[model samples]
Target: MNRERIIAIVAQARAGQATDEELQELADALDRDADGSVTSAMEESLQQGRQQIALPGREKADRMLADILETGQVLEDPGEEAETPAVIAPLKPGWKRYGRAVAAAAAILLLAGATYFLLRQSPRPEEAPVAGTNPLAPAAEGLPAGKKAVLTLANGATVMLDEQHNDTITRQGNTSIVKKEDGRLAYQPGNAAATGLALRNKVSTPRGGQYQVDLADGSRVWLNAASSLLFPVDFSGHERVVELDGEAYFEVAPDNSRPFMVKAGQTTVQVLGTHFSVSAYSDETLQKTTLLEGKIKVLAGNTGYQLQPGQQVVFDKIRAGSKLVPQANTEEAVAWKNGYFQFSGADATVLLREISRWYNIEVVFNGIPAGYELSGKIDRSIRLSSIVTALREGGVHCTLEDNRLIVNK
Candidate 1:
């Protein structure tokens, strides 16, 4: 809101003629003001009673804000101890019947002024986070992660792949490891007998980063942030095998002669040629293998579960037990690859863990949050404040401090 608009709203509020929407806007503006608390000037003016007149313009509002910085910031207002409560007019008929209440106009002036001030001072969200830069809030400092990863060569040499180089990154055995134009790493396999075969090269993404790779067999893998995949440059054995430490989505190349196997923790996922996703984070108790196309089998100890398309296998890491969810939400499972965090009644612990990885921040729970489960989908590029604000709406109180997210009751 502009200066003139705010002043107009305050005039209407003092006259008890402001519309509900206008008053609500003022209230919202005030809540975003300098800590939203009672200012020393307002307190003193209230005690004087002689100063009970409403602030006439932006200049008075400006003076009131100057007095607040000395006492520090707090969310609570001093209420009766501050300036006289701005009288609120009775709501329009049928408003109360809708079960929504209107706030008193006394707070409208403060809100409108503060809201206008903040909107003018702060950079809009669209200007905040640049590509490959940390887009943290004022309380924190850290760039949000991007599509990046580290490639561990078979000879123990590590190469940092920040973006598609459109050139050869390295050569392992007869396979030419190159970064394609689409930001994907590809292994072009030659005759292994002539160039020699490298055992295994590992690709891993740091927290807040992700990467994709195309194996020699035409298989594709999308590694999520804080995840790793280990595979040979070229597969020639009876079966193609890869080891995973975190989460990844795989589109396996069909080779009926050789089975494609993924070893995630103690459980092994075996597939011929299929589209599936695996979540095996060390912090999580269960390793999930959800299939989106074809069929796959999850094997742990003597227990094994076959998953059809749209099914998921939940393997408990501790119990080594496995179960099949016959009809799974494959879209949610692969949402990360498409750049979204999709949740349908997810636990706070699970949702926040994924958030922590992407934001490269810390999460410390002072007490369990209010909502045990929430269903939503958010773009990965949004700032941390957007997520925290959503949580607050779900009755979860949290504070984003320096490099840490403190979740309260």
Candidate 2:
């Protein structure tokens, strides 16, 4: 298909003047172009026959799309529709044509009244990102993070939580899956058999995504990007055990009679009830468990280490060797959970890696400069360019190209 022509048609749709055929054609274009790339993942599987079963909140999608097609109006919010009249302005003759405009239109289907897509490719930032990079004249943006995650049921079916879904998602045994307004997935337990074969459900956060889950045992787990948690539908055995592959902050429910345990990589943390966080990503070299309150035992190989409040245990998962640090920066260790990147002279590579995971972008380094470090507190909700600006301010030169951020010494 002529991509430019489709973009033009989508531009009309944004102004509320596209025909029903045009809208359907845009939908078809999006359906055929899911190559496991592109940022508008919310609308990718609509045509992949993945919608065999109706989604919880999908009944109104067709109607909404049809209404916009029939009448030139955008529904910005429920009970709050915006009247956007058409604006006619001609671009310069040599303006570069990009198909991201079409993807932006497709993103609007999932995000009603959305004017622009979040992850659209933009030009490499000049010395000044705000003044020189924006070709379409976007406002000064500090992009705040939103609810983003995926839920995998025991059957292997995956649900993208950031897209369309209703109050109640599913019923697994005695637990009811609920999608919260802020994009958190919670499991509510009913009076079902507490002791039986455990049916496990896993929730995973992609790169540049995070989510919170209320486990069946009344424990709350806040998951960082590139992390997954597997737990049963409800508490069954003498102990509650959940497996973690990435990073998570846990406020374990206190049941002294039945201990709660978290298995992350080669390390296991056993606690009756406590507030703590575990960072154990496979890509990272070290796994650190920081305790906030109460005492817990951490086991690595044959050695066992006990932790108290404000103490953290750092261990090399490969070597099975562990060390404990007192007066841990419990705040800095958990800045991600609190919606910030708190750094205190962190290494340059480490900072960039964390940025890559949170923003869902890749980082390519020109050279790793030794003895380079950065310190600051950056809001996780800010735009990619904002971070790039911060890095530049810290004497690390960088530029954003498409989905990858390139850094230079």
Candidate 3:
């Protein structure tokens, strides 16, 4: 608070009649302005002591009254020639010392009190703002709440049903792809075409989750939460393939006739209809590919590696040795397809980044964490704060500072 208000509060406190509301207001003000541990009541009590004593310090007037208690020691106790010490230290040095000392003492008390007050409050660190700019606001404004992705048939026909709908959707072609009311999308080969046609089948879901139909090439794909998969309705010409983002698991129908390919980020995987998982979030630094039941080739530029079952390749963009690592409990990698957040010793930044996408919120780091790792399996439908609280309970502390999630180091 300003100087006048502080003085008035101190006066009221000294009289032992400060109201509760006034005390609370004073506490809030001190907390906000003083940057110290002292609460309003404690500070008020200290101030009250200062007000009660009136020892002259800064000379308000030229002639000030000083208390003198002189005992009759000498016979003629200085009737005219008495030269005792002119200034006496008061029991309480309210005005006896210069105002600077009082102000300094008050400032010290404020700092000490604030430190104690905050330590007793909680372990939560203060949140801070993010640097640079916010990219999500403009992006949300430019894009629709739900976007549309379609599949174009070789015969120049398109099917649209990426968003909410009450009826079935169909694409006209030799092989007609249909999205049923139950949300199960499938493709059927039509007798109209003597030869199979090249079909681009696209399957997309909204914020929660969705699934897709790859048709009778026998390849079945399950798109995970907040994810999409783009593939051909039927394996044609060169290969059977699909593109993905967020997370998706594939059970490729063993097609000896064609090589199934999954494109994730800059990495490409070629497989002949085997089960596999790919997570290539554009915002993530690592593009991960895990082979479940068949052999696959992971290619990045000219560098290609053949991956056996139970092997995984992690393409690390920010470091050397973008080496391939052995797969962990494969269940964890494909847990999203089963509607779970399977974390394996992920750091705070990694966990929050995944949460930000699923919850559709922006993440900004406030400070460095203590370098703690998190591992667990949780349902993605849980509340955001609930997840945060759980992580805090597990020793990784965080707080919402400004619009960002600030982790404590």
Top candidate on lDDT is: 1
Q: Per-residue alpha-carbon lDDT of model 1 for 167-227, expressed as tens digits?
A: 9987777889999888889999876463435479999999889999999899999999999
By summed lDDT, which 10 consecutive residues of candidate 3 come out lowest?
Answer: 61-70
Model 3 residue 372 distance off true place after TM-score fit, in angstroms? 1.7
- Write down the lDDT of every candidate, Cα atoms only: 0.66, 0.66, 0.52
List, residue by residue over 1-409, the lDDT tens digit for candidate 2: 4555564554554444667577556555544544423223322333321335544443344344433333322232222233221111111111123234333343444333322211111223335444455321233232435567888887888888888476999888778999877767788888756548678989888887888999988899999988999988788789999999999999998998989999998789999999999999998878999999898999865568899999998888677688889889888888899766665546768877888888777788888745554443444655666556445543455667667777765
- True-vs-predicted CA distance for residue 141, candidate 2, Å: 8.2
lDDT of 2: 0.66
After best superposition, candidate 3 residue 355: deviation in angstroms?
1.3
Candidate 2 lDDT score at position 244: 98
> Could you estimate the TM-score for every candidate?
0.66, 0.65, 0.56
Which residue pairs come into collision in candidate 2? 143-381, 143-383, 144-381, 145-381, 208-358
Greater-lDDT candidate between 1 and 2: 1
Candidate 2 to truth, TM? 0.65
Please report how far candidate 3 places residue 378 from its true position, in Å: 1.1
